[model samples]
Target: MTVSKKRTISDESRVFQEKWSHNYFFIQVKEKAICLICQESIAVMKEYNLKRHYSTKHAAKYDMIEEKLRIDKLALLMKNIQGLYLSLKTGHKDSEASIKASYIIAQKIVAKSKPFTDGEFIKECMEVSFEILCPAQKQIFSKLSLSGVTIARRIEELGTNIESTLKERISKFIFYSLALDESTDLSDTIQLAIFVRGVDSNFNITEELAALFPMKGTTKSCNIFNALKSTFNRFDIKLNNLSGVITDRAPSMIGKNEGLIALIKKEMGTCGALQLIQYHCIIHQENLCGKSVGFQTIMKDVVKIVNFVRSRALNHREFKNFRSEIDAEQGDLIYFTDVR
Candidate 1:
């Protein structure tokens, strides 16, 4: 027995015919057959469906019109629909451009470490620039949303995307190092910053801030080690890949018996024969040395000597000439006291 297959909607040729527009006063607007009288759309493109809709709903009002009048009406409706479709198409493109611009502006603001409210200032600048260069684009520019809240949302979305990409790359790390620092915020809350520098099998190195953990309670060596272990677990990477640790070298970090580095070494030793390098931050070490040695006292004497030489016009000119003769850097002693 032969079973016949039913024809699917895809099998039918449903293109709108030209005669239907003139006879039924129907025209295709964005693929749907629309009646000129009521501006109602017929979902099915078949002549039968279009005819039935016109006869049932609008035939009484428009049936009395002459042939010339019907043709005129059809032409006017087609013109109006074309204009509306054109405007809608332009609006769609402008909307997409506005969204892209918003993201770009948001990213720039964040990269510059500016506040979210700066987006409003940026929008104002954009508006002024547009007005000066091309006033016709004011309407399109207005579609962009650069409010403070919108900027914040865009920045958060960007951060999430970057984090997602980093997670994907983390799984491929052949070796990695960590850098840690702790500081107190404006609210007096301690923030432990963890940064990762990882190398993949292809030897591509990626370095980024992994996380910032808040420590409202104790910030002991054990606390730091536990937090680090939690971070490693979250990333789902092997402990064997931890090749190095860089730290600010506080007593809690470098203590011989119970430091964070000592704890990590013990953990890695049990896993296997591993070589983990412990590094102290050079800049931090320098800062500590300067503070301990009273760098301010030394700088005070130097500043006094500079003032003695440059305070008088004669001494300043002689010093300048002497420096030029020696090919020294071009600068007078101008110290910014705020810098440490």
Candidate 2:
């Protein structure tokens, strides 16, 4: 009889062999695998013995691995769904916060006539909140605050709301009157400021700034009348409800021949006319009277001193510090009035 050759297998096949110990046996402690049920070396790459071992000893473990894989897949899917939901909720909350904060900022900016792009103002608000707030509060405020575009948009929204509210109040009034004055701003643009005064069912008087129309061409009586008519039309205000009108003593406004008052009276006619009273502004009359008081010399000296203190940067700074040092109640030295 001839001797049989000894079988051999690959040494590289021994990685993690213990994890499959129920089916595979180790000839060495960490190497040389053999099938547990078949008693044959797996190193020889024998498929029959491995398949037999699977059928006999490792069937339960194979089922457990498949179940674990499915559970793991389901858990990962749920985690992803939860993350998506949280992301959407956070975005909605941030949007609401922006709108709320923008509303307040818009009102304050309009009331104070502050610039929308004032970075110093926005930074100051952020910095103060950052310093005073706790970590959670800081997180909440990170979404709130100002940007120039956001401020502009919110101002428009608030303006619409205010206009609607004023319309509601004005519509309920029994009678309403208009007061108008034209003035030149620092830019030399003539702006006509209009105000409406209304009496409600209870006779409560409500007064509000109606509009500021810029006069483009000649600001004659007819032009002023047209501007007023356009503004009333836009607001749906009836000229017949107007019970009174007030204006400054300027000749263009009160002159009998082609003045704003005369034009208004003519356009209104007799039927539309009620007790349409007209009055010159008392403050303007007093300002005119103050001119004859012989105080020109004193007023000129006061103006010169105020200009000296305010026009020079160093002098202005020193004066402010001096006032602070002395604990002055008023920070400024002069309150100039438009007496001219």
Candidate 3:
């Protein structure tokens, strides 16, 4: 009973057996092999070749997707660094961490471009790289604080420019008037106020504050004149353009022979310097008239009688009662006036 001598397998069957037994990659389907894991027949190709195809093509697609993501992250980092550079250029105060973060982002951008071996070259590139990202309206100084010296220097510069502009316009005017006044404040500091009036090219009267100076001595005509001359020279205003002067009739301002008006006329000319019209202050004149001898004498007896009653506390009550009785009969108090 030779049982067909254990049907010896051929070379083809041996080769097939060997190939089937060898390790073969498989395609992932739902995290497992599609045919074997799901128990389905892969009619087109063997499991090994299918797995090789899926790995080479599908796995490569994943690598490309990851590379794209990395590139996008680098681009975002560069954009953030540019924003921080702009903020610094505009003098915006940033935290140390913020600066370091921006620097790191910039370093990453630089490093990824090429492998920088030289330290100096790398530093130079970093310095120049962020400069172009600076904002257009960059501030040289921060607005946080300013020293007194800085403020004063700026003011001096502005004043010099203004003075230069004014000098050019001053020569264009032919005639000008000067008005002077003195005032004392609550601090008892005397201020000399000066104003200049002139007609512009349009022939309209223009008044401007010429100068405000501290009075060193008494407001004398000579002192004021000297100050005016000095101020005019400082501002480059020509004295030959002086045509008129106006001042109040105070003794120092309008003394008969020695006053501001007299001094100006003496220095300049009578044609260019003339006294202003006298319109006496009505309130001051009224006060003086009330204290005149005629009005004082008329009120003297009434004042004495009132003071006699006011001096005694008991007589004051009786005086008030008497006055009330007289007022009651008079219907209302009447004030008499003299037409003259």
Candidate 3's C-alpha runs over 4 A off are: 1-74, 88-142, 146-171, 186-189, 203-205, 255-257, 269-340
lDDT score at residue 300, model 3, on the 0-100 scale: 76
Backbone clashes (count) for model 2 = 1
Number of the predicted model whose TM-score against the real structure is largest: 1
Q: Give each model a TM-score.
A: 0.76, 0.59, 0.40
Ordered by TM-score, highest first, the candidates read 1, 2, 3
Q: Candidate 1, residues 1-340: lDDT per residue as tens digits?
A: 9999998656886999999988788888778888876678888789899889888887888788768897888788788877887999998888999999999999999999999999998888888999999999877777789999999999999988987888888999998899999999999988999999999999999999988989888999999998888887877757787899999868889889899988998998898836989998988989888889996888788888877886898988888788889888884555436556
What's the candidate order when arranged by decreasing lDDT? 1, 2, 3
lDDT of 3 by residue, 178-251 (tens): 77777898778778887777765767566777778788677787888788878788767765667766666678
Candidate 1 lDDT at 120 equals: 90
Best lDDT among the predictions, by candidate number = 1
Residue 43 lDDT in model 1?
Answer: 82
Model 1 stretches astray by more than 4 angstroms = 10-15, 27-43, 64-69, 104-149, 270-273, 291-340
Clashes of each: 0, 1, 0
**How would you encode candidate 2's per-residue C-alpha lDDT over 1-340 as one tens digit per residue?**
9998764455334244333443333232234454433334554434455556566675665545455674564345445655666988998988797678778877787789999876337756776777677545566555665778878888898888888888888878888988899999888889999999999899888899988999977888888889899878867787677888989977788889899998888877865656578987887888888886667867888988898998888999999999999999988776467767
Error of 3 at 93 (Å): 14
For candidate 2, report its TM-score: 0.59
For each candidate in the order shown, give its overall lDDT on alpha carbons: 0.87, 0.73, 0.56
